[model samples]
Target chain A: MDSQSIATTPEELDRSVLPHAHEHPAFLRHHFEDVGQQREAASFGMWVFLLTEVMFFGGLFCAYLIFRNWYHPAFVAGSNTLDITLGTTNTAVLICSSFTMAMAVYSAEIRRRGQLILFLVLTIVLGSAFLGIKAVEYHQKYVDHHIPGLDFSIQEFVHPSNPKAIPLAPDMAEKTQLYFFLYFAMTGMHALHMIIGIALLFIMVARASKGAYTEGHVIPVENFGLYWHFVDIVWIFLFPLLYLISRYR
Target chain B: MTEKTQETHQDAEVHVVKPPVYLAIFLALLALTALTTGISFIDLGVFNAVIALAIACFKASLVVLFFMHLHYSSRLLKLTVAAGIFTFLLLISLTMTDYISRAWGMF
Candidate 1:
């Protein structure tokens, strides 16, 4: 019943040619049979990328687990030094971003362009808020000379400003540097992911404005939602491991 | 009476059904997050890591099942994803065995 079946004569074929000649976006490829196939491929690809991210973070976690067991006391002492309030706040912020991201994807699916844009912007705002808080926490650690580098100082641990502060063994205190190193490495990597996710979100917003996903081709939005949630899950793990692990002790 | 008819029947049978509401999943995730955070403040000794990871795993499963629509995906797709995760776990476990055994002086 379509025009393809009726395109027998040359004149008919010529008349149908101009409309069929309209090209999709340059980013869209030909190998995919349709928009659905393209979307599925994109989502699957993002999932695989996230799987690699897991392995990447898995290395840091393995290091933490091994070293935590080896130098349990030092690691626990180092964990105690972390500001739990900041980490928990960041976790909550990331969860809010994930919620917004899900809403963005849902809005796209339901063909609510304005809602999709609003949610995407909200997710970006929440993500930036997380990074801003993280920067402040890291800066506080720096001012306290807690950075695990050549400039790291153990004077505070050796001779505390408060008499009730636990005095660490000099050697154990040195080992705390390893803990902070792991902390910076792990959380820094996570923050890097957040930056990339936010950048991608901006790109998605631009594409969404062009009415790309408005017609119900919402695969990009959906895939980005997965990425956002995965990043959130990473932070959820990192928060407790770094901040809340030995707070009571 | 032919192969095409049999294939159509199988396709119908294998089709996935979507959930009526995603709000339940969202609420569950929020609850799990709060629960995990609250429990982390408690001194559970060695069980702390176990509990945290367990809750995280549960939350992740909920997200995958509902938000990602894995519950509605075909068997092949589900198996593929499971295989990917299984391989990652295998890598992590094998590598950790080496690292952990080093600490025990079994290296």
Candidate 2:
């Protein structure tokens, strides 16, 4: 009975005279005091990295704000050229992926290996769906000759393709290129981040299948969840700004 | 009982958000997305952009607080995020002052 009760104890007391001996799990780094401390340090580091990402994306946002204000009419014309249906669909897809990622982190915390794998797979699928829709939108833009510096035509903006469409002067129509330039810059950067994230998700899924995160080492999954959600937040703002601007016109 | 209490103590340090809360936040995000899109189809003049940005900001807050676990994080981490936001605002506002003043009274 004594042996069974002692075996049930969370930790085994070592005979070493040192205070820290045998108290921490193997996963705890030598530099850390305990598992809790290690987790805190890891999370703090991830937050710092995410803050840098914020500033990196912030620069693009600042430029976009200035250009949009300077050329409001062109900004409206450029924004209207985008397909709202696809934009909204992509937004919902990204949000779904974020939800799956959050669930994956939860699964790891609860040590459910199957659920973790399932959620991760779901997230990857949703992320790919977002990119696929993005590709379609880009293809449409290519066909419409909206791409800046490559076969861009200001004819449509200057001539008002639709009878009710408001026409812009040739000089102002030229500014539409700046709007599209910012559009490509912002969304292209966002897509590049998503591509990197999807690549990392593949590596994580491989490791997770082997039970890497379900064994009390959930920091990696949790940190990646933060990243996935951060990407989604970027799109949340992008959707309304790039697609919804002057849609009522 | 002792082991259970110890486990609880460890869990208290880093709160594990449950599935229900995640689902709630997810639904709320979807609903808000739809709301923003629908509202955009109505002409609100400058308020259209204002309302859209307001909704986007709220949605971002939901993700940051819950998905990023900032709400349950230590004070130090929360302060770090706050500082980042403050710097971002400062960058935008400071630059705008120069731009707006350069064209002062020209419009």
Candidate 3:
């Protein structure tokens, strides 16, 4: 190595150093005038990405609302079959993940590499926990034959395990299949987002290990934090709408 | 370069005190989440939807203001985001209008 290319101390690599400097090729973008501009543009771009996601999920929500109103009785019965405990737990887990993701961004800002990594890992773990619980719930639905395909069985609703249980008419029970279809579609989409977020967290962890964000360019971490929180927010809406409505009935 | 030009350029990159406010907004978000969930168990009839949506809007506002840093951003960026959401809302509302009005015809 040339003497002019000596390694600089961490303290010497402060925020005043232009983030657009050629130290990291991956961090620079041709369209951006500087690192700040690059970061701002990237964050704005992410918001636009999230807007599209909202619209994507928004379609499912519209379908759900329509079917829900058209067959209110069946929708209520369908909601009652969901295990509220599991759904509520998943909601809490997702919120905790959002909290940790926010802390990860804050740690990056404060230049605490260890804390940033810790929170990022915590966020990933919490997210996985949510998906795990959701899997179990889905499995239970499968065993009960509530899955919304042609294989779905209406026996559970017509022949209630408890004599006092609400006996849905065959037509209403069939409409329940529509409710389950929307449920799986919406929650499945949300879970897909969680998986993608976890994958990105892995990439962020690798970059963070190289002190990318710790060097004061924390905007990547921050922008990713926003995306994670937006995903969490979508689930927050989904949980109540899909799993909690008329659950006590 | 003229002194006025230099001053204006310097002001462009001014580092505002945004971090603390962002943290406070984060705390507000946590509180709002808890509040919304707690209220959901109550029998609010049709008002539950209104309340839930209201709280969600409040939470979304906090995220947009603090985490997304819209409060510190330029007017152009703000308009860009607003336009996107407005367009989305328009789509949702118009589509729902068609579906919701169909209910009366079915009766």
Q: Docking quality tier of candidate 3?
A: acceptable
How high is the CA lDDT of each candidate model?
A: 0.73, 0.84, 0.74
For candidate 1, lDDT tens digit of each residue in A203-242? 8787666665656456667777888888887887787678
What's the TM-score of every candidate structure?
Answer: 0.83, 0.90, 0.82
Candidate 3 scores a C-alpha RMSD against the true structure in Å of 5.2
Q: Against the true chain A, what TM-score does chain A of candidate 1 give?
A: 0.85
Say which candidate scores most in lDDT: 2
Q: Any residue pairs clashing in model 3, and if so which?
A: none
Please count the clashing residue pairs in each candidate, in the order shown. 0, 0, 0
Cα error, candidate 1, residue A49 (Å): 1.6
In model 3, the Cα lDDT at residue A106 comes to 76
TM-score rank order: 2, 1, 3
Fnat for each model = 0.21, 0.71, 0.11
